[model samples]
Target chain A: MKKLINAVEDVVVDSLRGVAAAHPDSLKVDLDHRIVLRASGPVDGKVGLVSGGGSGHEPLHSGYVGRGMLDAACCGEVFTSPVPDQITEATKAVDGGAGVLHIVKNYTGDVMNFDMAAEMASMEAGTRVESVVIADDVAVQDSLYTAGRRGVGLTVLAEKILGAAAEEKRDLDALLALAQRINEGGRSFGVALTSCTVPAAGKPTFDLSDNEMELGVGIHGEPGRETTTLGTAADVASQIVEPILADRDFTASPVIAMLNGMGGTPLIEQYLVWGEIAKILAGKGVTVARTLVGNHITSLEMAGCSLTLLSADDDLLTLWDAPVETPGLRWGC
Target chain B: MKKLINAVEDVVVDSLRGVAAAHPDSLKVDLDHRIVLRASGPVDGKVGLVSGGGSGHEPLHSGYVGRGMLDAACCGEVFTSPVPDQITEATKAVDGGAGVLHIVKNYTGDVMNFDMAAEMASMEAGTRVESVVIADDVAVQDSLYTAGRRGVGLTVLAEKILGAAAEEKRDLDALLALAQRINEGGRSFGVALTSCTVPAAGKPTFDLSDNEMELGVGIHGEPGRETTTLGTAADVASQIVEPILADRDFTASPVIAMLNGMGGTPLIEQYLVWGEIAKILAGKGVTVARTLVGNHITSLEMAGCSLTLLSADDDLLTLWDAPVETPGLRWGC
Candidate 1:
């Protein structure tokens, strides 16, 4: 594969080394265990937040490890879930007097691993841990790597919102309830203009013709719902938004809309798509209170975009507007 | 070309509409003039900073407009310089009681256009405008789009540093001197793994074989020094760094280094490449005090990375650490 990696097996660790080097003062890396932790240890009475999955969706878990975000991120191999031991270690490392919150995407491997780690942490360290799954992707009922709806873009929002609550000294149960409420409120759908190659596979995970696209693709380049001819940005926005609006009732409050790029697209194209999406949302009478447009959570070099709409009240909005000092998403600090 | 655009001609304006839609509160768009201005207009007496080039290199001009950064950005068409009228409009619009600073990249068209605009503003609006041209690309003595050197990654650093200086109410002469210093202290080099396709061009800008890559490539897919076989990230790091070191001595002070991605390269690969660059810089006794790794200034969907080293003093460091609330580079606010 034409990637900037040293070797197939060393991609995750090498990138982590770079992450550590770039933000040495703000982050500390456990090279042997493959966990990224905040440089300053966890607070005494604050609930510790931890979230991770595969390595390729960058700025996701690892880039979010800082103040107003996660305390630790357990990174696995590219597109592979972290093992139980890594998660268990991160659970114990971020644990303070307050409990730990495990924010997981709705992949089968991720769900199982985080569950096992939670069990292990409770049994071995005597730390109370609560696990929450994010299943916002409305792409399919099940995909190659996931059971239920795949957790795609909502995980990023979940981390930020829940991390703020954790920083406010919310207990584990309160955080768990907030996580579930967010899980029910937000929904995401993705499209792929081109497929991406995994380091181990060395070839595109799926194939698409020059004029075709994969609607509702997973974050790992798995098979999307349909492969169809590509359309204009306006038409593409309708395809993504109609399904999301049909799936949920977002009229209760203004929405926090995220137009996320699936790696290989440019900010220009992302903005073009977001412009059309905003027009469509306005036509549907949905006020976009806040909007984010970029590659915050991305598949590895896949050219596409995803849309996530989170129904929010003042509380959720306030938490989202709180100071976050992470690598990927930072503001108000 | 497989792109998510409605029509090739509408790319720039359509995307600006998206930018306006995404950041309505912090940004105000002049659709007729294609200028992005701060929603909260120019400060009463701050030296307004305005910088922009072609449209493809995003988060470069538009994303840098905000408090403690730029007061305005004049976006040109993709890979093309903005006209003099747009620049004159932006110059007058962002001019408070104080003067204005025009940070132009050293491309021929950009220099000529901004110069004409500065002259026009002086004659028509009686606004004192000082221009600083950044020519920091270390790749070639001359390139396809530029006369002496292509201003690439260093423009981002110049905007940020100069913007911070302007925020402190520096006069036009002081900001111009600081701009010259930053322009002298910074140097950049880039490489392209594959050519980028301009939407209007309907094809890749250049051709490269699977095993070949363009070393010292320009930001706009202009021919670099050579097209050689692709190497490991570490080897590639040496190719970019050795020339920069030979050209200038960076051992005098710790430098702020930016490992920037050309749109298509994922963050994982960017970090992997940055990791190798860090090792080489350390070996050369060049201390890296601060590092930024992401697609700050990108060329559409080009697959590549560029490095910028800006020699910094404590004042520049403090300004760099100051609060910036723009969409692209937001921190410490």
Candidate 2:
């Protein structure tokens, strides 16, 4: 590894310093806790949102902090969920009088730790802590053997929408309900084009031949639900969309569509995939009121893409229109 | 190349669908424009903030949209700048009665396209467009080569702070001024432990030996200033921090610091890196008021880290403390 730094151990610290230095206006790095927070406290009378997982998923928990999204984000090592202690500290830091909502993705470790932290926080100070576990990926047809649907790209969408609801002074229960609705309505299925190596793991997450691809992989480099031969963009779209459409009954409703890159795929390719999805949705009489194409959530340098569809309702549309301020997802006032 | 998808061509569109499906409340995919936006009209009288760049750097332009950040974000292909047409459309869409500010990272393609789009928008409507190019990475040392110090990690911070300022209803010129101040005060340097493969390129961005790393790599996997033997956490910090400290006269001043991951490095190692950086900064009499760790900005699965430092003043601190509502960054109310 030909690198530029003086040492490997100092990488995270140096990088943290860089983040602090770069955005002095919006964030303060609590070096002691390795926590990133908005310089001031969160809004009043609204549930404060805090989320985090591994470090590799940038602009995620941290980037999603601000006026309408997360209040603080605790980042762990790359591809590794933050420790319970870190999550505990973040829950404390972000909680105001209104309470704190943890948006935890449904990875095993993440779920375990965040669940423990929520319990601990509640016990610690009678501080109200609520958590919503996002399991939006529809890739896993057999949720029996696996932990469940791996929370992939939908976490980003959940955080933003719920962040807006919280910003709108929705109560903790309301925010929680809205988050669950968004999570339930959303489904994701990802396909990798190439393998990504985790630094600590120091190996490719998985292997695939040039002419083959794995379907329904998790974000942490986990193997897909199955493997398949190479195909055209339209055919691949059919495989991914068919599952999501069938699983969620999106064929009869309006949906918010997304074609997300798995870190390495280019946008030109994403647009092409979008075209295929659009045709499929139109053929099925599924109305796509909105669509987003590009890499929103990623798995390191994995060369692949995922499809997410959200069944949208008028209420959800209103909240989506609400203004927010964070790093990753924002829109309407 | 082992991938998760059935085909390479469907990556982007599939991923976008996943994103849209997950968060129907906050973001609606403008399929025609391939832009992500808040599902409603712009806020009245607030300056419309728009930004974009290559797609690989997540939680970037897209994640930073919301209340305290960008009004809209345009995403390009992986590692490739979004076309001018996209920027033009985003600018038009986000423009509320106020002018628009384009927060562009300092890349040749990004600069050219954003500039062109601004010009094009000017030709179409009276939407006043101002652009601020962020060039905070200090590794390159000289702008004479390689498009100057490539805007690496500082973009995330710049966008959040500037987004907050925009939310504060600052004029476009004031927002521009604040953006410059943030950029001027910030400096960064990165080291890559391993090379990441661009999906379309279908190969490692650069080659590295088992025991070496490339220093000062850009987010797009651009070659860095030098290649060095891998060292410890402290050693890497010294290399990255020394240059940043030398580049600016942050001598004994209070500083905001960041230790950012380049996707692949784990946080356990990142913390060890932070430990070393803290000691060095203390030795240098640099008052480190805040620090951030983990991957805020990344370059796919490149294993490495970046260091950033910003000299902080009361005004910058105030802006950093302001409320924001984007999906990526959040804070004060």
Most TM-score-accurate candidate: 1
**lDDT for position A193 in model 1:** 94
Candidate 1 residue-wise lDDT, A1-333, digit = tens: 677878789999999989988999999999888999999988899999999999999888899999999999999998999999999999999998899999999999999999999999999999899989999988788888887899989999999999899999989999999999899999999999999989988988988999998998899987777898999999999999988999998887999989999999999999999999999999998989989899989998999999999999998999999999999999999
Reference-based lDDT, each prediction: 0.92, 0.73
Mark the regions of model 1 whose C-alpha exceeds 4 Å error after superposition: none
lDDT of 2 at A57: 58
**lDDT tens per residue, model 2, A1-333:** 233334444444455665565456777777666678888766667788888888665556666677667788887766778888888888877777789999988888888898898888888867799899888878773353238777888887787778778877788888888887888899988887677766556678778887877778777767777878867776778887887877868865677777777765544455566667777888888898766665567675567788888888987766665676554554442
Q: After superposition, how far is residue A330 of candidate 2 from its true place, in Å?
A: 7.9
lDDT of 1: 0.92
Predicted model with the maximum DockQ: 1
lDDT of 2 by residue, B1-333 (tens): 432333444454454564455446777777666677777658888888888887656556666676677778888877778899999999988888889999888888889999999999989987899998888988774443237667767777787778777777888889888888888889988888878776677778788888887878777767778888877666877887888888888864577777876765644445557667877887888887766665567776667888888887877667666776554454443
